[model samples]
Target: MLTSDTDAYYSPGHVAQVVAQTVERSRLKSVIDSHCGRGALLDAVEKSFPKIHCAGIDLDGNAISHLRKIRPHWTLVRGDSLAWTAWERIHRKLGGSVDVAVLNPPFSMGQVKGVNIELEGRVLRGSLAMAHVITTIYHSNPTRVVAVLPESTMFSEMDRQGRAELERLYDVEVVAQFKSSTFRGARANSLLVGMTRRKRQRAASSVEKAHYMSLHNAIVRGGLPCFEAVSLRHGVPFVHSTDIKDLVRGEAKESLRTVRPFTRGIVNGHMILLPRVGVPNKANIGAWFTEDDVQLSDCVIALQYRSERIAHAAAVNLRRDYEALASLYRGTGARYVTVGRLSEWLTNARNTRTYAQL
Candidate 1:
């Protein structure tokens, strides 16, 4: 039910709350919302802290006009947030640096033509415009930046390259995820992620500290046990989750794949761990590994459960590690479910001809 006609759309109130929290924690002096559709978040900031100087920018002239009527004193600019050249010029004119920048940019979709291709052919792809906007703003020396984005930005392996590039330039500190329903009519789950310049290690450090605190609280309240009881050890290369395909076909050593190395210093017992690679939300996509897969060095193990009996057994056997892993999964929802049953389902489905290939 919640939607915006502006180019920089208005996010849900929860997103505004997260932005407010980030700003308060950073003790920022100035604030700007790059894609400030309708200025809902900017209004929230103004109402809560009247003295803070806030600005809103949007390409839509009508949206800017409406915002000006609502907050006559606040500065609102009409411009494209993604235009790096224009942004650089504006930054120089605005006395160099800003304290915080928040945004909810358009999720553009389209195709491009290239050489060595047919005239009618096109490749499907997600837009990098919004990501580029954030990157550009960060380069402008903003101390803190927060944006509301689709969950795919965090979970999809398809965007790994872009995500890695962004991470290299700016440290992504916290990701507070919410379901699609939380946004009323949004198509995908949304997340409020905070980014800061790598040069400001203090800001990154504080954000990380807050992230752990929030994660711990969610784990404690989500009915999941803490991970302190379960044991974690480095998995063997050959037997790692990635190498499962190789090991199953008799292409690798089975001895190297066992849990021996992981349980070496601690008490010997069975534990549930996930493969280091592959997508995180395997349950939603029904993608997983089987017993016959090859073992790769990137694999790691944690406590797992399928039926209630299995969960109980795993909990009892690896009480410490189970709690630790569960804490990690608390706020993440089904994206972090145990790998045992899901892996079996994925392997079986992959083996079946009727199932569509990923």
Candidate 2:
């Protein structure tokens, strides 16, 4: 079956066989494949769990129609796996949430620089795939869940919220981690994860849930203004990556150049200049603190805070978490991270286990 291709990958028959065996070992009586594609997993599932009742949900009508004909005993529905209504239909058919959920959720979501997915009033931002697994855990309330996800799903800055929530709600166990070429014609690093719901814990209003809930409102974007227009003399003083050589070299910063400010008046307070584009490494990762109200070029990210101590603390925190933050920038090209991801990273670095965690 052709995949949705946005971020979803249809698990091959053999791959599904492996994942199904893992679920079968859990001895679950009922299972739901939230992103079931053409019933590949379901096919292997039938053999793996003969007595278990199975249900599958997918956005593809043809796949659901095809399954209805081929697997008459199975309950298959054509609708979004992310929508509440879709799950409602599945719940009605199954008599309640299933024992376990099998998932091959969408990954990366490369099209959007940032992603936000909310369920049951809790929101997860960053990776669409993480949101899928986390949401399934929330909506299904199943005892166990097994999913095929990107290897970075547990660590990436973009999926931090999902990871945090999962850790909070489940006893996570890694079923398997696969090579980038594990799936034919697919190059993403993948993994199989199994999670069992914890005993009736306190609700999300607990201390940890309050912290996780606070991250949903992390100021991801628009915190720092980008300025590109520049001139030799007339406009406000501006700093570029090249100008920060001495600062990086443990030398005093020289006079900065000038650029047109994006704001109407003088840019106020202490500013932080960060290199937005570069390869991922320690030399490339830094927290360049600046004291000018000057405009900064687009090449560098300019930020401000109400207090100088806060700005200094932020810079120190970013540098402290440099290695983890650098992971956010991946691939062979001149990698870059968006302001939103960076903001989320900084926020996570300080309070929660998302990065630094006291």
Candidate 3:
């Protein structure tokens, strides 16, 4: 059976070769593959740089034992790379010089097992792969770091905090984005990101300042939570995904309701709303607000734009490329779009055209 190693796909020989190629350009003496799986990466590094110090860490005992038997010279330790003890064992051996760090971490594992990250005094529910990247950079302080991560890590609103922290700490850029075909049986896309740690903090990506970056707060869950308690006829106007035929071109036609939310209060000023939970459709995928406020339902997503013009530009952009949004919906059933997917799309869209075009 062609299957991934639970939440992650083990790097194939060819994939390992690509990683080796990336590492070859850098002048480094020691290398570490935090999630080394079957050791394809370390093997490739050793082959390319014969005398380079190599260390591999994995949580799989069988894989580690097998690699140790085959390559007795390597320091293959079986432990979770996210934990400090694993590095301690490696430190006892390699003297803790992590010049180059390469990884293919478990993807989306946090969705099932859950991941809570506390960074700069804010709590984030990001992915496992994201956590791996952040912790690796912090602990190893590697001059060069390369890893395979999902696109959402860089573009998703849910992961914005982690990405900001990483970009804040390193000079990050995408080295390569691999199609699904790159991995034998892997269904999702992945990217090979190369990052160099910065001694001083630098400015973040423009996408970080773009209008869509703030959409994370607007992607609400199904229950509606604190907002659902208010009556539809008493507080603020309520809008559902099915209420509108298509997204409003600029500002929505007035339709008021009385729903009030205790948890998040009310949203006033220019707001752009999208369908948060539904089978993606060009028609039902968009909406917005100006001046007046409404209590958005579970099906709708809300993004507050700094001004009416930016909100109008956003609406125009959505209408122009709404078809692309339809393709982003993912799930076995009841497919839906995420703030990350939309934000990623916005970032790419912004890149393709000039600011004035929007």
**TM-score: which candidate is best?**
3
Best by lDDT: 3
Instruction: Give the RMSD in angstroms, all C-alphas superposed, for model 2.
Output: 9.0
lDDT of 1 by residue, 125-227 (tens): 2334335444446545676677776554543323433444445446675456555566544455556778776773444355534432222101000111122
Tell me how candidate 2 scores on lDDT: 0.63
Question: How does candidate 1 score on lDDT?
Answer: 0.46
Q: TM-score per candidate, in order?
A: 0.52, 0.60, 0.70
Q: Report clash pairs, candidate 3.
A: 156-340, 234-258, 235-258, 236-257, 236-258, 237-257
Model 3 CA deviation exceeding 4 Å by range: 1-8, 108-113, 118-124, 202-272, 276-298, 301-318, 321-358
Deviation from native of the Cα of residue 10 in model 3, angstroms:
0.9
Q: What's the C-alpha lDDT at position 28 in model 2?
A: 63
Tens-digit lDDT track of model 3 for 243-349? 54533643344554456553232455555666676654555434355456555566666655556676666666666766676677777888887655654455453
User: Which candidate, 2 or 3, has the higher lDDT?
Assistant: 3
